[model samples]
Target: MKNKKILLAVCGSVSFYKAYEIISLLKSEGADVRVMLSDGALRFANLISFEALVQNRVLSSISEDWQSGLNHINYSKNDLIIIAPASANTINKIAHGVADNVFLQTILASTCPKLIAPAANNNMLENFTTKNSLEILSKNGYDICEPVSKILACGDLGKGALADPQIIVEMAKRTLNQDNFYKGKKVVVTGGATTEKIDDVRGITNFSSGKMAKALADAFYYAGAELTFISSNEFSAPYPIIKFSSSEELLNAINSQNLSQNDLLVMCAAVSDYKPKTKFNGKMKKSQNELNLELVLNTDILKSLNLNCKKIGFKMEMDRALAKQNAINMLNSKNLNAVCLNVLDEKIKFGSDQTKIDFITPNGEFDTGFDTKPNIAQKITELAKQI
Candidate 1:
């Protein structure tokens, strides 16, 4: 995103505060960010705070930059327009082509990719008018960042919270990097630890933060792949997400996707190797001193997947010396095009931000020295495209 000009339009939602982190993320990626605020946004966001981060005067009204005479038109010249925390009212106005505010007026004049992140109360967001307007905007080529279901500021648990700042930024990068290479490519990334239910409340799982999978997902999205993230954890993305718990459930979810040979599947989830043979009907009582439960092997998801798509799998081992060998073994056993080897010991922590990976392909082993997950993910993404 270096040197890319971006215009961030903040609306009236209380969640407009999130724009701070959004700005920081974009600037950190070397984007030239300029902010435009709605009148209602002033109540929750300070112009000075925005100006300080962007290192430029914030624009709130059309009259402020009158010296240029084409201020609105010029603002519309950004490489991308992001309407974060796009309130329902603003959405409706945009749907009806009402460019009353400078933000909307500039958007009207802009032909650049537009990304909208809607945030509002449930009733407001689900209202007929609001829903209709969103549908209209989506049909008009606007990239809508679907809100996650969470407890709102109004104390209601529903689907109206603004998307994660990371996801919003990733979607913006995707919009900016939309190109021929990955434009229509399908990428499926599996994540999180799949659980084997022992009872309604208890289950066995692993220590996976899903960050590795998330990094892969984000990298693929930024590369413009049509993305789908299958995970046990809840997430908000501008693509499809299939939720699952047990290894069986995960397999079923992946099967449901109907992947083709053109697709790319990254198997990074920590799927349970064994499941309780006899799952208790409900919560297992602790009355017994010791419970000797029988275990059964779970079907290897990667090997069991009924598709011919090119696949890359993750192999996490305890010994650094044996990690590459184990990854290579899994690569052949699981019929994978490549495998990523991660050694977990005192120095390496699970579910963390940083990772040192070794990539084993049919060709040879390449050690990717210690680096942040995002950087490693980018390298893996580039490797996958070449394969």
Candidate 2:
């Protein structure tokens, strides 16, 4: 939770007061908390008190930021959104995609992981409409933290009070554990330059140092994705590595994994485009100055792989004007789900820590400005979640 972002959407309910305790609990866990209060909640919720803990203005219907709906869109990008003290009104609206208030609008706008913790009077919670809304939300992928039997603020004992703040925090943890986009997803990454041996001591390779591969691997690991690293070069990681020295070995390594359409693969390796027409098993005598060797095309791993899973390729471009078009062409021609385009000494270069890349897909292109490899890798990881 050290750097995790949490969005707490509070609805108008007697349990609204408990959002403070929940915020305190989450802060104790080191989470970065942002609060969004519904119009109904504004009556009981004091803006000044919330501002002290959130360190920002609480999102509300009256906020000027909602004019273009930008605030809701941006705030919804958090790692997790929790509707604590979810009232019957909010719960029903959420189930049906009705966006009357800021909270409901943000819920509809976000595809990130979310939790709905319903809190209302016992009769309100038991109504057929309320019960059905809760069911619909649960079936639609929102985690529902069912209320526990407790003494209500109205002097009645029932199972409709907002769950204990501690329980809501724990449920938040469990929700993130299960719904983090990359969590438990399988990902295969290819790196290093593929080699083609002309002789035992003479081989061909590219300028790839596999630095980006390590960075990506680290990013995916932190993101909770199950990882498989494929490379000819050695690198240290906590995940398993399947080593290969040639295009054939690399293909075999990929094919051996039994990957499926649900998995993801990133082709960052600078594989040789051509190989020697005739490879020599033994070292040749100092080849004559006029020595000649025929070259032939190597297998197109990206196109030839027998995979249905989403695949992303790295396209290296030497010209800026043609870079984006080239990447789009590669995306289509190579049958890739997306392509990351890097131009030599411009957007990206060999052996550099930082990079600027354009993420191109059939939909469009997203240009990531100059940034560290790790930061770029994290951005790519986010894109991977969608693709």
Candidate 3:
């Protein structure tokens, strides 16, 4: 946040007081923050409060003096704009280009990135009009910190609370440093365990949770990469995702993506090794006797890709020696530039947040000791920098 200019626009809500803490934290992080209070904001806090915290004049209204008249224009040149405790009315106005006041006028005139944290009654928040307005703002490229669901001052349990201050600040830092490594690069990440349908009611799948892929996607996005995330997981991705359910569907998704030599592909998904040769049209009936099933090997998606992009694959082994062997086999047979190896264990089982990953490449092996998903992603990102 060092030397970054941030503009804070506070709207009316009980959570408005949190804005002071936000400003203080940003300032402590070496950021230069300028505050503006919406008309409704005065209901929760007066101008004197913010003035004392910021140690600068709180911009509430346009000054009559021509020299002071351009304060909005000058302050709007911030690197980022944060609107906390954004009411439903404020959201609508910002969405529709309503700039009747200095605060709105400054936002209207500035091209800096925006992050809005809305706080309102449940009814107002769930209103269809508010939903459409937020969608419009998002489509227009505004970053939103979605309101949390909690007991409001009105005694309703629903979404309307302001996001935590730490989250807002972290997002600010991420937005400000978006020009890090991998900026303007194209990245493709595959996640989750693909299933093979056995019958109408059941299928075969692994225990993958897609957490690793999500972590890598987040890191790549923060680094400014244009990412295409293909996943079979039921969890929502941080960014827009191209979803698939089965191995065939995942393979098709991979085939459909436009990949090139400059692109980076992380094949982290656990695609099914085999699929039932014939799927039952209806739910398979239970029987007292054992049932015989025929199966066929599924296509190897990594080897099937014809692109010249750099590729990474994952191999889960039951033992350390087998892991090394399988890693080398995948690196050579699948034409992967690198392979990540993990030993299947009770503690480091699938879907676990902690993982001990070893990256094998032609140059050497890199071990990222037992670490969380985010730290593992950082290690992978550092390797991406070298590549």
TM-score of every candidate:
0.75, 0.55, 0.67
Of 2 and 3, which scores higher on TM-score? Answer: 3
Best model per lDDT: 1
Q: In model 2, which regions exceed 4 Å deviation?
A: 1-179
* Local accuracy of candidate 2 as per-residue lDDT tens digits, 268-319: 8889999999988888887577888899999989877887788999988787
Order of all candidates by TM-score, from best down to worst?
A: 1, 3, 2
The superposed Cα distance between candidate 2 and the true structure at residue 107, in angstroms, equals 34
Any idea what lDDT model 2 has? 0.83
lDDT score of residue 146 within candidate 1: 89
Regions of candidate 1 where Cα sits further than 4 Å from its true position: 1-4, 10-31, 37-53, 60-77, 84-112, 117-142, 146-167, 199-202, 236-238, 283-291
Residue-by-residue lDDT tens digits, candidate 1, 1-387: 899999999999989889999999999999999998988898887788999999977878733577755367778888999999899999999989999878788888899989999999988989999999999988897989988899999999999999999989988988887756777788889999999989899998988989989888888988889889998888777677888888999898887776788888999999888988978887778897898988999888887788779999998889778777778788888889989889987767986789888888898877788989989988888778766
Compare the candidates by TM-score and give the number of the best one: 1
**Prediction 1 global C-alpha lDDT:** 0.87
Candidate 3 structure quality by residue, lDDT tens digits, 22-104: 99899998998878888888767887888788776777763313366436788788899999978999999989999998778
